[model samples]
Target: MQMLDGDVVLILGGGSGLGLGVARHFISEGASVAIFEVSQTKLDALKAELGPDVLLFKGDVTSVDDLTACRQAIVDRWGRLTSLVGSQGIFDGQVPLRDVPVERVSSLFDELFHVNVLGYLLACRVFLDLLEASDGSVVLTSSVAAYAADGGGLMYTASKGAVLSAVRQLAIEFAPRVRVNGVAPGAIADSQLQGPKALGLDGVKQSDIPKEAMQEGFKRLALMPTLPTPLDYAPVYAFLASRHNKVVTGQTVLLEQGSLNRHMLSSAGVSGGIGTPLG
Candidate 1:
């Protein structure tokens, strides 16, 4: 039997990139999926690609009304909600504090926090009742930036850190009724991750970054040489959202490809199987 059979899932920002990938994975696992996205164009594209098995709605993550309406639509169609996935986020182009213009600082901070931090909070809040009724789970999309520097700029990093904190707190508060967890992926290649309009980066996407440049950066920092795709990280969210996973909660799984520990050990020098210890 499929892992998520009979499950009803709601994914915010599920039109493209990791969100889109998660939606597809859930559907394949026998879950009925509903997506809340701000882009009509992306929603239309996803509808055409995934067919009617996937429900699509257009809404901004920052709007409580949009979230409420989306939830109602899901309940009206699916009868109940079994899981909630928060996958909406924006990047900061790794613009350091020194480079950030003072004039743009406040707006940039607000824009990124609204989508990255506030968006997750609002999603959880709006879905609380449905999730409680079903004893469902929440899987939030965090980033390597949540725990490390250089993963993103100041604003982006701070916002993701807040996500980690929320996962822990919410887990404690909602215990025995709902599970809250997170997945922190790192340096995805060809991601549709966008940036803040306040910084004139709304049109900019991670896919626009040169592949060679991203590879070089990853090679220098990551112990694992392979750069992951959004599809590669989808199953983690699927596992977390599954009803079978009852023990794990209040945790943020690090999907950083060993980048977190690269500082202490070098994968570059190691080759072949484990050899005799050197004296």
Candidate 2:
């Protein structure tokens, strides 16, 4: 039997990027998925493409009304929900701490926290009853930014860090009924960058992110020397959202290429300086 047969998963930001990839995988594994996307056009396109089997809702994660309505809609359709994966994220232009204006950084932080932190909390609060009924799982998509400053700016990193902490506490609070965990993924090729005509997103100038420069950035920063694809991390999410992951609650699973942790060890002035290893 398929691992996720007869399961119902509700994914936030599911119309594009890693969320879309994970949703597709769940469907393939015999699971039904409900996608909460902020874009009506993308939601419509996804529905038209994926058909009636996949539920697509146009909603913003930061709005409680939208999230509540979406959850109710899912319950109305599916009768029950077994899993939830929060994959919503926002970037604050990736500027350095010094270069970014204080107000700009503060606004970005607030926005990021509202979407990434509070959004997850709202979703979990609304769905916890249903998840408890099924004794199911909730998977949060954090990023390597939680542990490393390289993935994004300060706002993104701090928000992700909050996510990690929330996972631990939520797991403890929801124990024996529902499991909570998080995934911290490294750099991946987001489909959103395919073209200017893709998603109608704003604030990102097309000329600023040339293909060659992107490649150079990845090569210089990524530990594996190659950017990962969203599909590459899909199974990890699927496994975490399954019954088999019951014992893995409160864990922050890192899908990074082991580079972030390695960097700390390479740094000097820690425990007898550079020559000694932790062992």
What clash count goes with each model?
0, 0
**Candidate 1 lDDT tens digits, 1-279:** 999999999999899889988888888999999999999999888877888878899999999999999988997898899999999999998888888889999999999999998999998999999999999999998898989988889999999999999999999998989999999999888899897898788999988989999898778777786889888999999989998897899999999887677663334575543878666
**Which pairs of residues collide in model 1?**
none
Error of 1 at 15 (Å): 0.5
Best by TM-score: 1
lDDT of 1: 0.90
Judged by lDDT against the true structure, how good is candidate 2?
0.80
Model 1: residues >4 Å from true position, as ranges? 263-279
lDDT of 2 by residue, 110-205 (tens): 777888799999999988999999999999988888888767767677888999999999999999899899999877764342211112224463
Each candidate structure's TM-score, on Cα atoms with residue i matched to residue i, is 0.93, 0.86
Error of 1 at 190 (Å): 0.9
What's the lDDT for all of these models? 0.90, 0.80
Clash pairs (backbone) in predicted model 2: none
